[model samples]
Target chain A: MRAANERVRVAFQGERGAFSEEAAIKLLGEEIELVPRPTFEALFTSIDEGASDYILAPIENSLAGSVHRTYDLLLERTLHIIAETIIPIAHHLIGCPQASFDDVRVVESHPVALAQCERFFAAHPHIKRVVAEDTAGSVRRVIERGDPAYAAIAGERAARVYGGRILREHLEDHHENYTRFVLLSSEPRVVADGDKLSLVVRLKHRPGALYYALEPFARRAINLLKIESRPVAGQPWQYRFYLDLQAKMGDPELDAALAQLRERADEVRFLGCYRSAQRTEKERF
Target chain B: MRAANERVRVAFQGERGAFSEEAAIKLLGEEIELVPRPTFEALFTSIDEGASDYILAPIENSLAGSVHRTYDLLLERTLHIIAETIIPIAHHLIGCPQASFDDVRVVESHPVALAQCERFFAAHPHIKRVVAEDTAGSVRRVIERGDPAYAAIAGERAARVYGGRILREHLEDHHENYTRFVLLSSEPRVVADGDKLSLVVRLKHRPGALYYALEPFARRAINLLKIESRPVAGQPWQYRFYLDLQAKMGDPELDAALAQLRERADEVRFLGCYRSAQRTEKERF
Candidate 1:
């Protein structure tokens, strides 16, 4: 799908108006072609099959911890992280052309979206809350049904794409809600000045193992952006820790710390060292 | 609601025929009466407000990593665990009168229930999957709609409660899928012979921090049943680890290990030491 190496084709999971798509365009700009996949595996397969040059997926959300499937997929696939971006989420309540507050009976959207808009729904308890596969998919359903009683809670972009009217905007309870997306490619890219390193480490199932695992970062005074753990399969009570540190793998100090971490850890994998995107101004509620 | 100290009133988050209600019954038996709450917070609030003696909540599933909100709520509330039980999930495809496989166009259930029945829906792609607040709630929606084309995937108990017929049984993709429920009470209960201890530990950001965290169990050869992590609010990159160990807190070795773990960890909190339910053979798929 790429005409040249400069124009990378990125694959993401979800429909056209998905926040993931918004993240992809924000990070890569509007020049690159975006391909949508139904599932996370399909996104990785697209990269592995050479159908796309890169894949952009949400790693974590400020409100909803880590996207476990994305982490598991990252561990399963051999793709390299090339960049990262944080997208501010501004959820909106949308409805069909003939729908109004009085006509609406059911509101549909993803569980996460519905949860973020808890305050809005709490104010109007009469409307039935329904969870759909995707936010845009819900919009599509409302359009297809042509039922005035059906509405969805999604992004403003989704409302425009599906030709739905915005019944209410900025419905999320929190203003700091944001989702972090990681860009992965088949080949690695050079880490620029403002790059971040991501690593996954499997430690020995012993006392003080994780303490020793984090010693390197602590000793180096490195700023850790995030740290999470997932169950290590086949091992009854062990876990593999994933961390994001504010230093590139190429940095001498970071390289040294990683080397020390590797010596103490049972297994260590360098997920990637990628340039981090600058945080955009917070969207006002 | 308590007539005597021996009897306790437990609040569960679900309707009358929910699996959660069944879990509450199994945990407390006929001696304790169940107070059903529509939401998880209500269950916790019932305990906090001194309206209930204890609360039984589903913490995790074998297939799902963790019921995250439960973890967050556990951290937010000061409730202590007094007992725990494991429940095997058995999902059933149910529909109202006049609705058959051919006529069904939409299937509704709780998000978790819908996820468990992914394989069934994949085989019948024409049927749209919808997510309701709960399994029994989905059945209630079908009954309220009185639409033959609208079906629901719920538990057999829910089907009977809502006067629906089973279109298909044992719809979960994984035959061995089970959910782990924790019993929370106002005060800690005495640990008996067959008891398990649960703890929440926060480790300092350093290398081998987690390894050191679990050293107590590893040194004494005490079995750890489960370990999961949740982020600490206001502290980016820091986490609080939740662990379930096989031995009770009263055990000399367990006590020593916890002491050492507390010394090494940034913070340590003992949720409770409670009797673990007997493991029953899973029902036939």
Candidate 2:
């Protein structure tokens, strides 16, 4: 751990005012320094470059499934998942101070952001959607152009950062939409207790291989929160299964189950044990 | 079924020469009529509008996980999945006939397409990448403008349809990129023999719910291909599990497995039973 006087340097992918940045502040509080990277590759390499003390990367979205790049990178890079957090993804319609919702003819954002606001676009058929590389960057462009006809759909913090007016609020199609992010560091921190566990395992290619692998947890009444099997690169038709279980590392039953899993499966890897973001009180928008 | 001479009308969510259209033709053969819908909502509602006989929608990608919109829409709509197909996703950089690769300074396509060719972008630092609404539409625009400096990354079929020249081939970072699409019709087709099975189940909220649910298949030595649990909308925390298994509809063991599954789970719905595209030979790129 660093000194109390020195603030934590957190790195996230995107422009200054991104949803990832908002999540980092909400989880780490207002005293941390934010370092923004332009791409996923850059964000993952920031820790190695000594640009930041920790990296916050999105693992999955409520509607969208897993973020494949983050999952693959977590395995490839030598980093530890210290903690995870979730935040509501709310996109607001931002524009120049002179512009109102009615004056907006074109809205710009990342394609995924544009896709999420389909209902808003459907309601306003005359407005056109243009795609940008980043959501916050689009707001900056609109503010720089000072065009009443141009607007952007992005997080609320973007409007504050760019000094743009909020033309509309909550343009996202789903209110329950949330993205889960994980904090990564080079060294693993000692945890006296953690409620969640994540692991990756490769099983023998057979019919009952997975069933037997899961039997250890089932027999002990452990809850398997999620299971995802990704194709192993260079090995066609083979998969590496990722499982999220509701058990801590220090538990005796958990240790016994892992011991049984190691004997049953071809290979097993323990990623981390952390508290579930679900256990925390959700922030009301 | 209609007469064999008349063409089958299939609707897909994209422009005329999209990868969806290519997959539909590759699966249904060239005699079918292609109906291009502008959005996923439009594509799903095409049958209600009496615009098409069937809809071909993408379910998942080898790189990306399941298409969430398609999975959610599949549950909401009354359509039945009759057939499924997998096709290689080969992105090619297309420019005007007069332009050469050296003259290109800008690239445009769907955001996902641009992202898949990350290595290409990394190599050509001078080429600026822009995001368009659709991949095929980008190629059409590039051909219409006839600018040497502007090019679009899309499938080879898009270049042929738009009369553009392929500036570079195989721009994807991974060579094994493939997309799986499912054919949905209002009426279910009768299949005398099929090897693959897809079903959805709502499990009882318990610790060992999923493990016990898969016990029947394990006991019968049936292969469980994939399992995905999606959160039940509005129900919060609860999930509806979707499973893909390697068993046919007429098998005695499969029937017994289904009987046991129904007894163990709250609800079970069979999505489809058809031949998997994996059994077919992959096209050499």
Candidate 3:
């Protein structure tokens, strides 16, 4: 286990104000030096080459569901998960200084953001909605274009970063929308309080194979937060299952259960036990 | 079941020349009047309100996973799947008249399109990739901005529709990239020689629930084309499974298997059985 004052460098995919960056800061804090990587592969490469101490990546979102690429990257990379955080997604509708409601003919944002703001757009039938790559990137586009007719649905922080005014806040249809992020570090941290264990296991593609693979956790009464599956590369009709168990890896019961699971599973990889973020109560302003 | 050549109005979510438009046209043909809906929910509401005869929505793509909202909408609405079509996605890099690769600093398009052209972007690291709501929408932005540095990755048809120049064609990383769209009509369609079945089922959130849910198809030797699971609304830890079966619903064996599956499932809904698109070799050019 690494010491706290080691000046851990964390890498995240996206620009400065991306939601992923928010997750990284929340997990590692201001003390850690942050590194930005353009792609998920680059994030992993940074960790592998010691360019970054850790990589913070999104695993799943409550509304959008699992990010399959992140799961595939986990399987492909040798990095270990040392922590986890769940960030609430509060999408806001923002516009540049040159734009007003009357002048705004089109709204630009990520598809997920657009989908989230469907209800909001329903009222403004005249305005065309456009999806952008990243929330911050959309804000930048609105700034660069300087078009009064163009607005973006992005994060509140993104609006501030890109000098965009907030047209509307909390534009997502669902209030409980949250994205879960996992921190991948080169060195595993010692399991502590609030730690949640994550594991990736490949089971035989046969009846009751999953049942046998999960029996160990069930026997230990270990609560699971989530379970997602992604197809194994180069293998047809086969999948590798990713599981999140709400127990520290250092726990005696969990350790024994994992050993048993390893024996039953065709292949089992420990993705490290990380501290889970405390569920936040919805804030009313 | 609706007879062929009957006048039917269909709603699609997108502007003209959008892939969804192509899918809608292919399914309903020139006989049906296509109503363009700005939002996906409006497409469903149009059918529910009897404003349109049917709706065409995308279910999944080979590269991008399932369109989850569509799945949730299917569960929320009473629309029936009357047909299905698979469209090969050929992304083209397009730009405004004055834009050139050397002058371009930013490339904009849908996230899926941006993801598909990852290798292309990697080679041109100087160009920043931006995402938008739609490929055509991105082209519109480039033209609206009139910036030579702005390029869009869109469909060839979109380039023609938006009057943008095709800077580079066939930019997708994978040649086999395809998107499967589902046609939801007010009434079901009779099974034909090439008909395929689509089913939605909910299983008890037990360890072997998924295995049991898949048993019927496996037992009948039905080729499972796609299987996706979305969280059941208001039910924590529960999932609703969406599947596409290669066998026609009219087949006695498949009918019997579906009946058996319904008995075992918590809730079973037959979306519809419709003709699968004929597989053709993809054009390299």
> Which candidate should be chosen as best, given DockQ against the real structure?
2
The better-scoring model by TM-score among 1 and 3 is 1
* Model 3: per-residue Cα lDDT over A69-115, one tens digit each: 78878877887887777787899878887566677788887677788
Instruction: Give the runs in model 2 whose Cα sits over 4 Å from its true position.
Output: A1-4, A235-237, A282-285, B1-5, B235-238, B282-285
Q: Clashes in each model (backbone N, CA, C under 3 Å)?
A: 26, 0, 8
Summarize candidate 3's per-residue lDDT along B1-285 as a digit string, tens digits: 556766777787766667887777766676667677756777778877767777888876765666777888887888788777777789988888877767888988777788878789889889888766567778877878888888988887777777888888899887867677888866766766646777888776554455566667776677666567676533323467787777865689887888888877888888887777643323221
B43-78: candidate 2 lDDT, tens digit per residue: 999988988999999987776656767877888887
How big is the positional error of residue A126 in model 1, measured in Å on the Cα after superposition?
3.0
What is the lDDT for B47 in model 1?
77
Kindly report the root-mean-square deviation of model 2 from the true structure over all alpha carbons: 2.4
Model 2, docking class: acceptable
DockQ of each: 0.24, 0.49, 0.18
**Reference-based lDDT, each prediction:** 0.78, 0.87, 0.75
Candidate 3 docking: what grade?
incorrect
